[model samples]
Target: MNTKLPKLEPITSEWMFKFINNYELQESLFKSYESPINIHSLDAFSRNIKEYQEILATYNFNSKIFFARKANKFQNLITAAVANGIGVDTASYEELKQCIDLQVSSDKLISTAAIKSRKLLELAIKNKVLLVIDNQDELDQVAQIAREYNIKAKIGIRISGFYYEGNKLLSRFGFDIDDIENLLQNYFTEANEHLFNIEGFHFHLDGYSTSQRGESIHQTLDLIENLNSSKTSFKFIDIGGGILMNYLRHQNEWNLFKTELQDAVLENREPLTYNNDGLGYTNRNGQIEGDLATYPYYNENSKASFLKEILDTTNDSSKAVYQRLEQLNIELRLEPGRSLLNQVGITAARVAHRKVDARGNHLIGLEMNMSQMKSSSADFLLDPFVSYNNPIKEAEPVEVYFTGAYCLERDILLKRKIELPQLPEIGDTIIFVNTAGYMMHFFETEAHLFKRAQNLSVLGRKEHYTFDDFKTE
Candidate 1:
């Protein structure tokens, strides 16, 4: 309600926003498979996986794409990734068991939690997945387990580096570079040759900006060089994923398009005017909606280029001064949690109620909460549209703020002034765009007066959905 809703039409100019509307695309893909509902189109996930891999390889970095099972933990994604030969990274007992159930080979899975339960740790060890041990005590404990089992365990020592953002990373999750070096040279592997075979280094970071990752890798590169000179090992570097989705990048670059589309949503119209198969968005009033060109950003390079550029900077000898160690051959792995699921998904909810607040503000409370969506972070801006993709029946823009099912005022999802098609009726399904990542189901509890939302994944062109995967008990 902060900004007045504008005329709400697509930009009449050059490329800015290339909408990746995954929900509309999925409906069409799910047509081929019978239990299409049982499977979702992980095609986007597959696309990002390879694209990111090749980007790393461009910088002469070895690539191992590990799917962070924590993001969605959807069986469909797991099945598709395992079948595609992608490695899986699990953080819990259920995730571990899920791997077994999905028949994901133990070799393809890695157990990486800064802190884990004994049962979970033992379960991971028993399953033979690479265990990323955190903290000194756990390292000692893992060393003990390696000795007790008489099996040589492949390990990655996570290094807690300083944040380029200048925020102190005091989380008790990783070893300082000095500590990892000392343990590497003095104790860990020596304490139990049967157990700890530290193969690489891993670190988890926040968000998708590439500079942070490059900085961490830069430091890790130095660590690898010094450690290799002193000791004689190290092979992999796990840069935990927070890469920006292509659609997200599009929104940022095409700020003008998104701004207009943001206005159009409430007005119930197109974001572009298209002809000759180009993706249509905003246009003149009563403009024909067909023949819009496919919004092209990913293939031609938008955000991916930024990511690749960051990786490319490593070639600058001045930055990666550890040239000899760079030759040791290391596979760069990314555990992307968000980019993989872009647009291929949607969260549906019936409007719970409509009420007018003190300032004559109309508030539509949805059944689910906004905290579920990860991309809508402090910096995660959302340009959501009604995902139906059909022509809009209502044309007037509805200017209102949204509240969640929870009673707390802070439980709201969209804090910004969003433009939705005028006067959405109670019980009408509201779809939040680009929510396929962490938005669908991260913070669901049967707290307060609200009920949990149902999660469904779309498969091929049939637009079929698999429900009940996230139905609360």
Candidate 2:
């Protein structure tokens, strides 16, 4: 399928309604969870995983995918990932402990975050986790901790990649590539028998730039070789992340929702009947008139296909570009944050209040907050899931602005102008689609005292259950 998006819907209708509708999965939040919510968006994590496995096949790269736990703080997400062959990335001691409690092997869990506490350090030393060292300070600290725990562990350097144009190129989390003081050379070079294990190198690019990622892997290998000086000890170079997911053909960019709330001033009107006899209805695009024989096909190809393509390109280019740094020598590592869990989760909340301002503006207040999501912008900032049960037809419509219950003026979620069947009631649930990525349900804003959104999971093919039962052991 074309990677580019089609004529976009104002909201994520494809995942919000189409996918859920076909599966016949019902949301249970309507009665118990909170008020004003009757059946909200359901499990996004479960839905995405089955799709991501397909994306992985696209690349033919079988690198272990360690799901970045910070992306979504859901235990069910961790459960789903552990169930798959993929691993988990935890930066904190508690998260690491949770990983162990969840039964993930120490080799599969890598400590990637730069900052760490004494407790976190102790666990890493005791558990023998793949500690990704950042700089001299961190490297020294790791050495001290390892000595204290006396564990013969593996270590990897967070190497800087110079792909970005300017000084922004040096990774904030990794050692400066220009700085020869990387752990391998400075700490382990003169040691009698490997002061540190010196596993390999790792680096992560922020956005979805393929060339930047390719160059990052290439540069990491170069940095590793230059530092080791023909005496390479380790066998892994973590590319870190950037495994794209396949979220069906229709719903690609879930965050592109835009809402125009300024003009929303809801006005109730009389209900009317539809012309079911094909009186005013017309198939302008022949959409309703097509048969399955002529309709375009749906591609369920695996996500691995894309990874393999990039991996092949990187591996192929490395031979001529950086001949000494073997391409197939080091084990490829990845921490797929969103790609592994994007389709497996969704967020559901209730609409609390609705009103029209003095200038004829319609407003909807939901119980969910924007900060709950790791994304900078609110859902529908690029695309929203608009309420389709609007009373006013498109030919004659009034726009509505959606907001959250918080006191701040920035609490708005959706600004898409649309006609609605009265503002969402105190009990109506508004679900956010495809929130299984970085937006998983753990941002219980302490600033606002917003309880962490309750996370739920679908067991096997039938049981729909809550996440509280699967807490840290």
Candidate 3:
């Protein structure tokens, strides 16, 4: 059956397109580093940073962009981000220590780890990097560590339970917004102020809604104002990252795919996804229920514009969020992970085998595992670039699902069935672009003792690019 699949072509950077088109370079790198290698471009990363900085520079309020380190674990990118005049938002002891060891100044780093250990607290206090406390337990831990070191640990309290449009948004990460004032009154007394220095408030919302975020900002501002006093003055409000970034080139394609997916789920058409996976859609008594659970891949307003929208969010009665920040001289801080790493890296893997599965579905086996390129989304929706080992040979068009190295039955690399001009041969290269954010190394593992993919940072794209141009540990 010849199937016509919807294409989600990704927006690529110059370096990414160059590397994708360079078959010789890919062959050479795969030959040297073996199959399943991730290549990142520092230049693309820096350019993304500059875009955000330029957008923020237009505003009057002081601002800082902290690169969330949990997005990608590359040390090179972390150091490069700080060198570009941004801070690093470390989430763990290792993440914090690495930044400190790299000589990242205390001001350029913040520890926002969900679970803070004693050692993590000690390290953050020693380095004087801001620690975003989740609860009173964390606060007490920081206080103990500060007393031991005889220095106040600068910290921020994370607030949640934001009410937007008369509904409260719930999150397990931070203190409830309603109780923040009470918590402050109890903990941040004049005597206890010496133990912990309150820097500001922080929050991370799940979805990409500008109005909700703007309302969140208004609520946080109100809390800051209510709690403002002689011993307490907030300097910044961190609307933590969940900034949207566009991935697909066409909106019609995304729309069509969604329609087709629903139809496929309802058994009204052929399955677009492997095994007719619902992807959060369910047939509840012959009616479609639940929305697509995947990331909204086709964003109309993303990155800087998305941020601007949030800042410009205000009703007629109140000032814009940014204007209020300007009036109060509050530094607007954001920690962007995926958007910052946009077009910065791609993961390449060689085809290991091609076969027909038990259910008569064509499966292309890749050298890598699902975790190597997996995200929290239902699927990585973008079409992969293929580098055929032999393009001269004539072949038939084939539609196949890419499988991974894991032994489990559900280790399908991509849930979507992709149509190719020809069946991929053994040792052919499959390049998944724009995977630097959470796709590359977020959940990579060594289950069954398979060696992890090597991560190499591509220094520059030149005419005679050699292995020396790629940096690998």
Candidate 4:
């Protein structure tokens, strides 16, 4: 079955180009690896950090950049964040403890986990880490822990303002906006006020809408103003992370592909064979509309530039984001996960076998499991770059789906069919680009007793590629 697919161009850095061009080095590395491997670039990560710092410098107000640690579980990234003097956003008990053990200052760490266990709360209070209280119940727990430990818990309240498609709350992580007054009246009493320090407000949004973000900021600012007479102090606004990353370089192609696919399905043309119907959207007419399962693969603003856009956005006539923060004498804090990790890492797998499926579809099985690259999203849209050690026989190009070594029928690496210059043979390497963020470790497991992929830190330039094992533990 022939179908038109969107051509995706991945964002690449100088180091990535050098690494991809050095096929000999990559082949040698893959041949040595018993399992799939992830190549991380410290240079690329450093460049991303510098970009954030440079953009943040343009604003005149007090701001802090917190690297969301859940983006990737690699310990080197945390070390890099500490070395760069930036803060870390940890969502787990072990994550907070690990950051502290890595020598990261307690003030530079923010624990925003939804359910903070007693052990996590105790650790946060004992270490003086900033806790982003999710709800009144969590606040009570923190207050109790603080009263028990006789230490003031520095905390921020997370607010939920964004709504889903049907005006439903985006997530259960934050308190409803209407409950602000009730929360203040119940918890901000003189008896419990000194037990915890209500330092600021935070909201974690699901999408990357600058206007929505600005609106949230305005709402938070209004809340702070409303609490002017309250006993509790609020000094900052933590707009929790949802910074968009442009994974696809050719966005128009993606849009056009979606339109064409919808038209095809509506016209009763040969349907695009997805592993599951959930991969694409089905309209009321029983026609597949488009692929709604994927994230916004192409965004206008991403990484440091997105932050600049948010800062430049005007929430009111008198104040832009920076102006508002300055006028209120409050700090602006950000926790960016995926955007900060743009072009920092990639996952490479060796082709183990190739065969024609029962439906006449060509399938290339890679040694890596799907869990290694899977995230909460339905499928990773970025195209996998293939490298062949042997020369092609000048045969016609073939479209094939990449599957994993797992025995499960649904263990496909990429749901979409990708056209290769030639059919891949055993030992060829399939490299998925820009996978450093949530793709690397999120949902990763050693299922079927197969060992998890090893992470390698790439160093140096062309002609001399040095590799170091990045310890995950």
Which model scores highest in TM-score? 3
User: Which tens-of-lDDT digit does each residue in 205-241 have in candidate 1?
Assistant: 7544566667777778778878877545788888777
Write down the TM-score for model 4: 0.92
Model 4, poorest ten-residue lDDT window? 464-473
- Give each model's whole-structure lDDT: 0.57, 0.54, 0.88, 0.79
Model 3 TM-score, all chains together: 0.97
Clashes of 3: 0
Alpha-carbon shift of residue 251 in model 3 (angstroms):
0.6
* Weakest lDDT window of 10 consecutive positions for candidate 3: 1-10
Poorest lDDT segment (10 consecutive residues) of candidate 2:
258-267
How high is each candidate's TM-score? 0.73, 0.73, 0.97, 0.92
Candidate 2 lDDT by residue in tens digits, 75-177: 6666666666667888677788988887778877888876877667667767778888777777677777777666665677777746554544755677777
Ranking the candidates on lDDT from highest down gives 3, 4, 1, 2
lDDT of 4 by residue, 1-473 (tens): 43655566677767766666667777767666665888787767777788888888877788888999899888888888877878999999999999988889988999999788989989999999989988766877888889988999898889885533336445777888778878888767888866988899888887777777876787777788888666666889999888887887787877865665565556544444354334566655775655577777888778777787777767547578778888888899989888878888988888899999888889998998989998887778777787777757786788888888778888888876677788888987788889998897898998789887887776445445644423333
Best by lDDT: 3
> What TM-score would you give candidate 2 relative to the actual structure?
0.73
lDDT, model 1, position 348: 47
lDDT of each residue in 1-473, candidate 3, tens digit only: 32467778788777777777777888889888887999889888898899999999999999999999899988899878987999999999999999888999999999899999999999889888899999888898888889888999999999999998788999889999999878877888888878988989999999889899999999898887777755598999999999999888899999988888888888877787888898889888777999998888899999999999999998556699989999888899999999999888899998999999898789999999999998889888888888886875678878889999899988998899888888889988898999998998899999989888888997765765666789984
Clashes of 2: 50
